[model samples]
Target: MSTDAKTFLLTGGRAPCTLELARLLYHAGHRVIVAESLRHHLCRFSRAVARNVHVPPPRQDPDGFLSSLAEIVNQEKVNVLIPTCEEVFTLARGSGRFPDHCRVWVEPIERLTPLHNKWTFIQEAGELGLQTPMTWMAASHSKLTEILRNINGKFPIILKPVYSRFAAEVYLLRHPAQPCPALSVSPEKPWIVQEWIDGRQICTYSLAFEGKLIAHCAYRTTFTAGKGSSILFTPIEHPQLLKHVEEWMASKKYTGQFSFDWIETAEGKLYPIECNPRATSGIHCFGESDRLDQAFARPETASLILPQAGVQRMLSLAMWSYGLFSVRSFSQWRNWIKSLLAAQDVVFRWRDPLPFICQFLLLIYFWKQSRRHQISMLEASTYDIEWNGEY
Candidate 1:
């Protein structure tokens, strides 16, 4: 470990991504303090966390969140503020408020808004000479009808909000006669109507600093919690795709962590689908403490790769329990058992036992919110928690 250790303030405590980052920073000899909106969260219980502070939710109370965070930065002498979830929207929106010494590890709100908005992202990608699907933006049902008539693609169009996470409220339409729920798009918020492309899903997590790709890891999601969240991650090499990402980031002069959802057609054409301007679960695939240290700060020494080929990192609890009840089969059961025995659960570290024990509290919280909101268990966990700048 280096003698000059930095103090990091990580936000988004309820996310497993935060726990993974805490472990990485702590092992690299940095003081890992966590600030969270929720009272009970996995990252708060982690032994890696040097301190835990509570704050008002960024989406619900932006001013309060900023004040609380400013106090924490000054008191802790935080060297950096890293947001691990959608709350990055709020943080980026108030980027100028943080203390001079504390660097907020995200792009400016101006850059983030387009990338966070799906409709805007597609347009921006196309303008940048990147491959993007034909997408139409709609602010109302009437506008959607207009787009439908002019669209050049076949049936099975994909519709989703311009800003959302975890694939919430995404819809696939097979025909005009199919019952479609009314979209919530308006002048304030918009929706995306895209040509549904058939291809393999490829996801990448990259850490960029001042337009340079310092470190990155690409992987295929072996299993997913829903249409969006990956439960199991298996890392792979995609040199061309990575190069494309590098050039794209350099062109935009992008900074901070970015996770991209992409589609690769059968002919090997890569089309960027959407961008999440925050950390994702792919960090778990890079398990080395020293490598993470270099990836974030010591970029000169960093060489990023999967810990090993064919290795699996998973949220075992979600995969096992959800797999057993949702879709029971001998093959799936065996795979789940194998994942439990062979793969590393991002939340469960034997050295940090309390967080593993306390994780169940989140499930209970999700369950209560799910019923209260009349949503699915997955949506309940993230619906209110993830602020897409919608409100």
Candidate 2:
């Protein structure tokens, strides 16, 4: 083992972002162990991972998940434990269970999970000195109906569950008179109605230590799986934008991975939509380099790591399957070609290629899960790990 290298246990090995992160850490001379709920995942076949541990799904069995994680930390002598998915919430809730030697890169549930809540995040972001979209929380059917009546169709509105991933439950209201869909709106599963902004979607993925930023990357999604969840990340550089977002996060004294979704209007004003306080595809915008690794491993001495210029990343499989269908016009086709030419597949590496080959198996896994659960394939992907205010 390298003298400077540390053993890292990263959760959510099933996610492409986690696989890419493991590659970055491994390339930097650190040992990476992946803990996932699924029997098969992308990292299971990757050369970057040193070990793969199957643990109970964090969303389904929080106690069992924590016990397995604690055992892994003590036995493997993990130096750092990073949660790369919604599992972050469960781990954050049970953070004290781990032994003393391991440093878990997550905030406490109280400080962290609030950011995951759409309703609270907007209010909190405003207090923290960031522009946020106008949002209203509706905890009951009566409240939701009243909020819709108040909107009066002045402009478009979007209703989404306060705790949802990938815009899976998003509903767009084009007119105020349209009857709202029947939804479970209660204290336990509240919804937020946000004023729709016409602008470019600018998303960020950042790693912070204490109140300071270690690495930051802002991206405008080029291609997406559906309405949300970008498959291609086009890194953009705007000093002023990055500065404001970084200062906003620094004000929270935030630690761990803090990511955001923002709407940048034609006038260049940014309105933050929600916060994910966990890893996102923005990780793909970065290369397998030591800067990000050093930032996570030794944040004190590490300088801010930014995305490499002119670099774009995509899920090549999605480009063919989902992106191809997205093209409807000649201009769209041209842009699609440009994006395809400019970006590299996030998974495929010429030297280390087994993981890329095995990605098909992971797809099959999701297919089986979707069929068994009678849900959308995208929902099935994170069904086991996604969190929604379960205590």
Which model scores highest in lDDT? 2
Candidate 1, which segments miss by more than 4 Å at Cα? Answer: 298-308, 324-340, 383-385
Give per-residue CA lDDT, model 2, range 268-313, as digits (tens).
8888898899999999888865358888888778788998888889
State the lDDT of candidate 1 residue by residue for 61-123, as single tens digits.
888987899899999888889998877888887889997888788887888888888988888
The per-prediction tally of clashing pairs is: 0, 0
| Local distance difference test scores for all models | 0.81, 0.89
In model 2, pairs of residues that clash are none
Quote the positional error of residue 364 for candidate 2 in Å: 1.4
TM-score of each prediction: 0.93, 0.97
Best candidate (score: TM-score): 2
What TM-score does prediction 2 earn?
0.97
Task: Report how far residue 175 has shifted in candidate 1, in Å.
Answer: 3.4
Q: Give the C-alpha miss distance for residue 253 in model 1, angstroms.
A: 0.9
